[model samples]
Target: MKNIRNFCIIAHIDHGKSTLADRLLEFTKTVQVTGGQMLDNMDLEKERGITIKSHAIQMEHEYKGEKYVLNLIDTPGHVDFSYEVSRSIAACEGALLIVDATQGVQAQTISNLYMAIDHDLEIIPIVNKCDMDSAMPEEVEDEIIDLLGCERSEIIRASGKTGLGVEEILSAVIERVPHPVGDEEAPLQALIFDSVYNTFRGVIAYFKIVNGVLRSGDEVKFFNTGKEYEADEIGVLKMDLSPRKELRTGDVGYIISGIKTSKEVKVGDTITHIDRPCSKAISGFEEVKPMVFAGVYPIDASDFEDLRSSLEKLQLNDASLTFQPESSLALGFGFRCGFLGLLHMEIIQERLDREFDMDVITTVPNVSYRIYDKQGGMTEVHNPGGMPEPTLIERIEEPFISASIITDTSFIGPIMTLCLGKRGELEKQNYISGNRVEIQFKMPLGEIVIDFYDKLKSISKGYASFDYHQDSYRPSKLVKLDILLNGESVDALSTLTHVDNAYDMGRRMCEKLKELIPRQQFDIAIQAAIGAKIIARETIKAVRKDVTAKCYGGDISRKRKLLEKQKKGKKRMKQIGNVEVPQKAFLAVLKLD
Candidate 1:
């Protein structure tokens, strides 16, 4: 145990975390780099150049003639997966804080650093990507020292892309990171940090042995779920599965029982000996809670079962994913799915299409609104269609977030203008090393969920990094903006917006729908309304036909008679013809600018 070191890397996206992981794996000879590059196994992650899931691997190395065991946990760098980072940190004893030398310290850099500190883990700062021509390693080192209060010599300079200083990083881990401390003779207690589903093994839980020994024949039970299963197998990760007869304390590995589904084994669950159960479950284990909610439906009603199966398969891989059955009069059967953030929602949608080969329509994303009625009752409404009637809603409350953006000083003015446009209130600003700045704001989640990130990137010219967390729910003047086609409300196109922007949002949506919705035989009047009052309207002009074009030199009265008859027929058809709204039309509205 004295020679074992457990650690994880923390960084913002594009800071070379995965590249560093690959270099470490190759340096230790734990796994071949397949050309000295890719460490991410998932095709999507490779294509996008980002890590969506946290991965753990056991590596063996020899430093100073002393054999060492290194457990490296590679976590997602995006802010959307910060919760996964937190869980990974809880299972380790130290963190490798990686900063992009060119970008200096970013918003997610500070956010992840705070999380590491909250866990009280030892941090080793590393300045990565030193090979870039734009690298500013000294400024970054100063930022790290300022934030961490560590000595200047404590910082390590490295480059994951060129494999520079890779040996030094490994040596630092062995020399600095403390070995895992636990009692191997104690009763079995383990943490289910993550899990995956397989047809052959059912549920395979990835765990770190906190105390006691778990063997192949041992019967184990989960403390939270209170279900027991025999340990069919145990093994550690070395880029691939390598079965072991037993897993001792301070070891990290995978366990397979008779279980076959994700529902049986949950992440953050505690596993212990069934007969010799520990006094109580491990502390700091909590189920993932969702922050964003949206309705998802199949384009075809018959695909409902297929969609259900696909969601179940996805839930097997993602413990934070939540869903339940829902029905809509307009969209038919669907599910109300909850996600940790907008990125998670998008990734799930893409996976459904790419992995499951299913075409699904997602409704407008919205945050849960707290509805307080005159009867002194409170209710949480996730969907606009599920909101109470306007008459009964005394006050509506929306979720807010405390967001931080780190960027160069030159772009601060434009970024602040964009944030204020989204109803953000500036709280504070701090100057970091050189011309970099960190600006904080309080803003509604509804605004941020739509296009805040995109706008921020555009205004900053891609120089800024952002991170946010749910702050609180506060009362707001809110209203539901409903879209009506031909004077009929379309439930799928309804959205909740702040009352102040209702007029302009209604106008923009009405005009956008007018452009998207195809013109029918009859004139279609697209109107945006709040309750029973219409705020904006647009007309798709009726298809016109030359009723008198065929009239050559005939009497003018004859042409008039024909035109009169055609007009009467058109009025009759307009009364009977029903406009067919397409699913793409609804999608266009949700994706409106």
Candidate 2:
């Protein structure tokens, strides 16, 4: 335990967290350094240049002829995956706070720093990307000092691309970061930080030993599920799973117990020996709160059961995803899935196609609302279909968030305009340094669910960083907007919006849908409505085949007769025609910009 150092890397998006991790691994010679970002093993992560999942690996480093075991967990830097960062911080005693030299302290850097401070983890600040020609090491060093309140000499300037100061970082981890403290004589207690599923091997749970020792072939039970199983295989996480006879206290490792169902193993649950269990389970683990809600339906109705099982397996890998069975009149049987953010939802949709070979349709995303009836009964509504009638409702309250945005001084005017258009109120603004400013706003969560982040980036020319947290709910005048195709309402196309912007939003949605939905044999009327009143409408003209071509040289009456017969046939087809809403139409609401 004295030689073990367990720590994680935390930073904002594209701030060299993964790159710095690769350099650390190369210096330790833990694995062959044939490629960049060896920790990000997922193909989706590599293609997108983002870390979607947190990866854990063990490394051996020697300092002054003394060997040390370093357990490093590389975490995603996006705001959508902050839960990953929190879980990694819980299992370690320290963190490496990496900041880019060109881009000074940003929003996620401050948010992650506060999370580490709450857990009482020792923070070793580093100024990364110092080798770039455009690097502002002096100014960034000042910003780090302002944020962390640490001396200038404590911050190390390193470049992940050039491997500069890699040795110094390893030395800091050995000297500054504290080793894990646990008793080997106590009962077995290990915290499961993360897990993954295997078709051949069942569920593999990665955990950190907090007390006692866990040996192979021992009977253990999950604290949350209370299911017992024999440990078939136990090993530590290197590049691959390295089998071990036993794992003692302060060690990070994985256990395979032949558990077939993913539900049997839960993240943040404790694992203990069935005979001599701990008196209590581990605490300080909070359930994740999903901010965005959307319905995910299979392309084929018979695939509903298959989709459910696939989601169950996916949930084991991503604990932040939550879902419940639901049915839609337009989309048939589906599940109302909750996601951390828009990007998280997109990644899940792609994974369902790539990993599980499931073609699914996702509806427009929205935030949960608190609806109160006239009799003083309150119910939480996640979808527009769940909302009660307006006559029976007393008032509706929507979720709000306190958003922090950091950007250059030049983009403040445009950003404020964009936020105000969404009914955001300016709370406070502080100047971090010479020209970098942090603006705080109190905005409704529903306003930013779709394209707010994208617009912010474009408006700031990719210099703005945004972060937000849930705040108190406030009463507002909100109405449910429904989309109708050929006079029939589609429940999956309904949404809740503020009354102030409802008219404009309805018009935009109608126009966008008209462009996406294909033209059929009969005219299609796309209408957006609130109750019985139609606020906006568009028509998609029919694809016509000339019935009068055969009467080209005939008399005028013959040509008229042919046209009349064609019109009657078209009228009949319009009555029985069913318009199929394409998958792109369902996602059109997201690109309403």
Alpha-carbon RMSD to native, per candidate: 3.0, 2.0
* Deviation in Å, model 1, residue 198 alpha carbon: 1.5
What lDDT does model 1 reach?
Answer: 0.85
Residue-level lDDT of model 1, residues 1-593, one tens digit each, is: 78888899999888989999899998888877886335577778887888988899999999989998899999998767777888898899899999999987776777788888887888999999999999999888888887899998888899988889889888888888888888988888898888877767677889998999999889899988899998888999887889999888888999888685556777788899988998777777656767677899998999999999788878867767899888876789999998877778888988899989999888877778899998989999888898888998889999999988989899999999999999999999999766789899999999877667767877876668787778999999999999888777877778899999899989988888777778887788889999999999999998988988888996789998998998898888878877767657766665678
What value does the lDDT take at residue 576 in candidate 1? 86
Which candidate leads the pack in TM-score? 2
Distance from true location, Cα of 192 in model 1, Å? 0.9
Candidate 1: Cα lDDT at 437: 90
lDDT of each: 0.85, 0.92
Estimate, for each residue in 103-122, the C-alpha lDDT of model 2 and write its tens digit.
87766777788889998998
Flag regions of model 2 displaced more than 4 Å. Answer: 402-412, 427-440, 457-469
**Which 10 consecutive positions of candidate 2 have the poorest summed lDDT?**
546-555
